[model samples]
Target chain A: MVAAPCCAADDCIIEARGLTKEFSGFVAVCNVDLRVRRGHIHALIGPNGAGKTTFFNLLTKFLAPTRGQILYRGEDITHAKPAEVARRGLVRSFQLSAVFPHLTALENVRIALQRTHPGTFHFWKREATLAVLNDRARELLELVDLGAFAAVVAVELPYGRKRALEIATTLAMDPQLMLLDEPTQGMGHEDVDRVTALIKQAAAQRTVLMVEHNMHVVSRIADTITVLQRGQIIASGSYAEVARNPLVMEAYMGAPDGELRGGH
Target chain B: MRAQPVLYSLAVLFALAVPLLGIYPVFMMQLLCFAMFACAYNLLLGFGRMLSFGHAAFFGFAAYATGWLVSAHGWGPGFAILAGVAAAALLGLVIGALAIRRQGIYFAMITLALAQLVYFVCLEAPFTGGENGLQGIPRGTLFWLLPLHSDVVMYYVVLATFVAVFALIRRVVHSPFGQVLKAIRDNEPRAISLGYEINRYKLLAFVLSATLAGLAGSLKALVFGFVTLADVQQSTSGDVVLMTLLGGTGTFFGPVLGAGIVVTLQQYLSDVVGGWVTAIIGATFVACVLAFRRGIVGELTLLASRARRTLRPARG
Candidate 1:
C-alpha cells in the first residue's frame, strides 16, 4: 500500500463502511468500505462478479444494502428512494447504456431534463415547442458531441454514439455524483477512449464513481482505484499502488500481463 | 406522412357520417363507445406494456356509477359521466398501486385476481342492483331537456365523444409522457437508470387509461339505457386486449380498428355462425397472438412507412 496520507474531508465524500448486499441466500456483495472524493474520478475495478456493480447499486439506492451505511456528501443516504437519490443529485448509468431507443436523441435528453424540471406537465405545447427545454437538451447533446444525431432515433445511432447519448441524458439531470457501471463495458477500443475522455471531462465538474474491468483504462484515467473481490475492497489507492499490490493482482486484477484485464 | 394524414381524415369523415348513412344507427353508437374503450385499453397494453385483466373493473364500475347518477338521481349526463371517469381513475390508482409491485405474467394474474374480487362485489353490492344492474337508465337528455332518446341524436353525441377521446389519445401518445411510457415498455430498467421513476409513471398511465375507459363505459351505459353485468366480465377484459392486438400493438389507431372489427365480427358471427362466436373470438385471439401481433392498423402503418421509403427518389 502506498502510504499517501488521506485527507478526511476530501476522501470521505462517498464513505461506505461495511457495505453488504445479499440476493436470496447468496452474498453478491460482502461487507466493504469505499471512499471517493468530490471532483475525483474514482474507478472500482474487478472481475465479473467482484461486487463492484452491487456496490454502485447500493450507493445509487437501486438496491438496498442488507448491511451498510452509504454516506453521500456527508449524509447517510442508505436505502433512500431512487428518485430521492436522483433529486439529491446522485444518478447512475447502466452497463447496457439505458436510453429511450424509440425517441429521437434530442427527445431522450429532453425527457431527462424534464425529470428534473418542475414545468414538465404543460400539455398545450408539444415537447419540441418547449423552447427552454429544447435548447438545454441540445446543449447537453452538443456536450456529448451528439448534436448531429440529435434528431435521429437513438436506436438508429451506432453503438458508440448511443453510449455518448446515455452520458448526455445523465448529464441533463445535472447530477452532483454520477455512478456509472461499466460505461465502456461493450465498446471497442476507440469507443472506449472516447467514453473515457467523456468520463474524465464529467469528473472535472462533479464526482464520478465508476465500475470498470479494464486495468489499462483505470490505470490511464482513474485518479484513485479500489479493487474488490468477494465484496470487500481488498485494495484502494492510486492506480500504480493498487496495480502493484500482489493481493490485488492475485484476487482482482488478474495477471496484468496485457492479454485480458477486461480493461480498455 | 401525407398518406397517414389522408387516411386519418377519411376515418374521421366516416365516423362523422355513419349515423346519417342510414345503416342501423344504434349499431354505430355501440361501435363508437367500444372503440373508445378499446383505445383507452390500448393506451396501456400497447404503449404502457401493461396487460390489465381488471380493466373491466374500471369500465363496469364507471357504467354502474354513471348509470345510477343519471337514472336514479336525475343528474346531468355529462356530470355523471365525469363522475364515473373520476371513480375509475381512483380505482385504478388503488389497483395499480398494488398490481405494479409484480411485473409481466404475474401482473396479468394479479389483475385477473383483483377483477374477480370486483366481480364478486358487483354481484352482491346493493348499488349495483345485485347483478340485475341499474336498469331503466334513461338515455337522459342532450342538455338535460333536449331528449337524446332518438337513435340518431344519441349516436352523434357518442360520435363526438369518441372523436374527442380518440384525438386525446393521439395527442397523449405523441407527447413527452407517451414517449417515456414507450421507453418503459421497451426497457423499464434502462428507463429507471435514466432517472425516470418507472412505477410512478406506470401508475399515472394506468389511472389515465382507466379513467378514459370508464368514460367510454359510462357513455355506453347511457347509450343502451342499462348497466349490464357484461360490462365488468373477465371476458370483457379479454375483449379489450383482443381488440387492441387485432388493431395493432403500439399503433395509435390499431385498437380502434380492432374494436370495430371485433364488434362487427360478433354481430355477423352471431347472426351467421350462431353459437360459435365464443370459439371464433378465442380463435381470433390465438391467431392474433400467434400470427397477427401487429393487427390491422399496425400492419397498415408498416405498409405506409415502407411505401414512403420506396417512394423517396433514389438519394444521390
Candidate 2:
C-alpha cells in the first residue's frame, strides 16, 4: 500500500491504491490510485463501460477487489463488509433510486436514522416509540424539499422526487463521505437543476464523491474531476483543465481535439 | 379496514360461545392450535419474506418433546411446553443459520430438506414409537392449580394462549424490528446499504416463528393426548402455507381466517367426502389462488380502500 505523497493522512477522507477488479479473465477495473480530498465534491466521469461503477463498488466493499488496498480516514479497509463500511460513515446511493417504495417518505428517512436509536433491533417494543424520530425525519424530508409529501408513499412519488428522497435518506445517515452513483440520472432539466442544487447543499459540511454522466452538473459542482476510459484514468484535474485535454475530448466526443461542453 | 376492531370482537365472542352452543370443545381447541401455527408461519413468510418449507420439523419435534415430558417424565404442562418451545428454537437457530445463506427457492428447499431429516428421525426414533406415535399424552394441571382433564377447561386454556400469542405476533409485526424486516423484504441491497446486518434479523424472525409454531404443537399434543407422525409430515408444513396464503400473507388477521376456513373444511368435509377430503381442499386452495391473487384479506383490504376513495368524493 502506497501512502499518498502529496497530501497528509488527515487531508484525504478516502484513498485507493492499486485497485483492480477482474471478472474471470475480463479486467473491469485495472490498477488505479485515487484520493478524495476532505470536504470536496469529487466527480468521476467516464464513458460507458469505463469501470466507474466497478471502482465505486470496490470502494464501498460491495465487491471484493481482485487485488488492491482501500484506506478510509488513513485506515486500511479493503476487507471491510459493506454494512460495516457504511456504519463507519462511508455511505452510498445506487445508480437507481434506492428508496423503500412501500414505506412513506418520512418512514424512508426514519429507517436511516433508526440505527442510532436504542430499540432499533427490539422486536417486542412498540413501533410508536419511533415517533420520536419523526421530527428529525421530517426535517430531513424538508431538506430535500419533500416536507409536503412526507405522508405519501415513496412508490407514488415522481421519479425525480424519488431521487430527492433517496438523497434525504442518505443524508439521514450523516455520512462523512457520501458516494452518490448518478444522483441525477434519468431526470428532466428542472429536476436535474433542483437535485444538482440539493447536492451542493448536502455537501456543505460533508465530503462527496459522485459518478456522473451529466457534464453540466459535474462542471457546476465538482471541485476536482477525473476522467476515465477503458478501465484507466486518462486525465485528472479541474473541470476546465480536464475538459480541454485532448484525450478527454477524444474519449467524450470522439474527436481528436475539442472543448468539452454541456450535458452528454 | 376501519371495522377491524368490531370484527375482531365479534369473532372472539363467537369463539367464546362455541362450547356453550354444543359445537365440540375439542374441535375448537384443535382449530385454535392450527390458527396459532398459521400465524407463526405467516410471521416469517408474510412479513419477513422467508418461505420456510420445513416448519413441520419444529412443530412435530415440539409435540414429541412435550408428549414425552408430560406422559413419561410426568412433567408439568407448563414446563413441558416451555421445554418444547426451547427445543424448537434451538432447531430453528441451526436450520435458519444454514437456510439464510441461500435465498428464494433455494432457501425453501433447504428448509424442506432439513425438516425431512427430522421426519426420518421421528420415524426411526425409539421414543417416538415409530408409526404408532407417542400416545396417551396427559393434559396435566395448569401451574398445578386447574385441571385440564375436562375438554371445556382445556378449550379455555387454549383460547387464552392463542389470544396472547396473537397479540404478541401483532406487537412483533409493528415493532422497529418489523420495520427493518419490511425494509429488507422490499429492497435487501438498499437495507444493507443503510447498514443493517439483515441476516441476523432474518434468523431471529425464524427462531421466533419456530418457537411459536412449537407452542401450537405442544398445545395440540396436550389437547389430543397423542403425538402423531402427521405432526411432522411435509403436508403439515404445506397446510400452514396454504392457510396463510388463502387468508392473506401479509395482513394481520389473514392467516387466522385462513386457518379457520381450512380447519373447518377439513372437519366438516371429511364426513361427506371421506378419502376425497384432501383432494377437495386442494381444489379449494387452487380456486382461491386463482381468484384472489393477494389472498382473501388482502383483496378485501384493497376493495375497502377503493370504496373509501369513491365515498370521499360523495362526502365532499
- Across residues A1-264, which tens digit of lDDT does each residue of candidate 1 receive? 222233236664677768888989889888887778878888887777878777777887888989977777767777677767787788888887678888889988887777666634433345554456888989999998998988999998999999999999888888888888888877788998898899989888888888877777887788898878887777889887776777776764355443324344
Cα deviation at A254, candidate 1, in Å, is: 6.7
* Top candidate when judged by lDDT against the true structure: 2
lDDT of 1 by residue, B14-128 (tens): 8778766778887888888889999899888888889888789889989989998987788988889889999888988988999998898999898899888888888888888
Candidate 2: true contacts recovered, fraction: 0.75
Residue runs of model 1 more than 4 Å from their true location after superposition: A1-11, A122-125, A252-264, B194-196, B310-316
Give the deviation of candidate 1 from the true structure as CA RMSD. Answer: 3.3
lDDT of each: 0.82, 0.93
lDDT comparing candidate 1 with the true structure: 0.82
Backbone collision count in every prediction? 1, 0
For candidate 2 chain A, which ten residues in a row score worst on lDDT? A1-10
